[model samples]
Target: MKTLWDYTIVLQPDNNGTFVAYVPAIDGCHAWGETPEAAQSELENVFEMIRDEYIEAGQALPDNVELVASHAR
Candidate 1:
């Protein structure tokens, strides 16, 4: 059986020429990179770690969570 986890990536400029990727849903799941693609790859790695931790702890994972991106003023 497989499940889907919703993730949102927000890019924020850092002090240097790099950017930081923030994943709010997952704790301690943030990554910094010189480009967006690199940040995304790092985020994937963080996500895998989170998933593994949950599985090892025998926790009940939630169903597919969809991330809805909307602009609100």
Candidate 2:
């Protein structure tokens, strides 16, 4: 069984006029996009990569960091 971590995604305006999305619970898990949806879409990839790295290192990622959405994204 896999333990999934729930994190709150924060979106902000970048200096370059792009949108930046990130998960506060995960360090360096951020990406920039031209729109909010794109930024969030990119964030999923970053989070997945980070999660894989943690598993490969035999480390457990943080769990239930924040509230998760009730619906699918």
Candidate 3:
């Protein structure tokens, strides 16, 4: 049984042509990639690690986090 965490990720293109992604609700959670899909994928991976850490520490996730529509991309 895996816990589902909803995190909002923002993706932006850097001047160097790579995309940068970050979760505003999770500090220090960010990643970069050559495309929007890659950036999103990396961000999701980061979210997983963050979620695991919170679960391990018995801490609550942010209340505002919600799973946005998958097709929103």
Candidate 4:
């Protein structure tokens, strides 16, 4: 089964010159890396985790969740 959910990844600079990614929809779900690519990779893992949790909790995942980039701001 394939399901989708609205997720946002915000990249912000950290003190160590690295970037940290924050997923707003999943509280406390964050990742940090030296590059944007790495940060995004981490975010993908976070997304999978959240998806699994939602399924286990019997929550229905959306058939298609459109992410509005503007709203992530």
Collision pairs in model 2: none
lDDT: worst 10-residue window of model 1: 1-10
Candidate 2, residues 1-73: lDDT per residue as tens digits? 2322367778989999899998777788899899998998898888888889998999987653564558777
Q: By lDDT, highest first, what's the ranking?
A: 2, 3, 4, 1
Error of 1 at 69 (Å): 11
Off by over 4 Å in 3: 1-5, 65-73
Give the root-mean-square deviation of each candidate in angstroms. 3.6, 6.7, 5.7, 4.7
Candidate 1 lDDT, tens digit per residue, 1-73?
Answer: 2322364556677899888886665567788889977877787787677778888999754444346789999
Better of 2 and 3 by TM-score: 2
Candidate 4: residue pairs that collide: none
Ranking by TM-score: 2, 3, 1, 4
The CA lDDT at 20 in model 3 is 96
lDDT of 4 by residue, 2-67 (tens): 422255457888899998987665665688889987987887787778779878999864443335
Clashing pairs in 1: none
Ranking 1 against 2 by TM-score, winner: 2
What TM-score against the true fold does each predicted structure earn? 0.67, 0.77, 0.74, 0.66
Model 3 accuracy (lDDT, Cα): 0.76
Of candidate 3, the 10-residue stretch with the lowest lDDT total is: 1-10
**lDDT tens string, model 3, 1-73?**
2332355667899899999998777787888999998988887787789888888999877754554557654
Q: Give residue 65's lDDT in candidate 4 (0 to 100).
A: 30
Displacement of residue 21 (Cα, Å) in model 2 is: 0.3
Q: Answer with 3 or 4, whichever has the higher lDDT.
A: 3
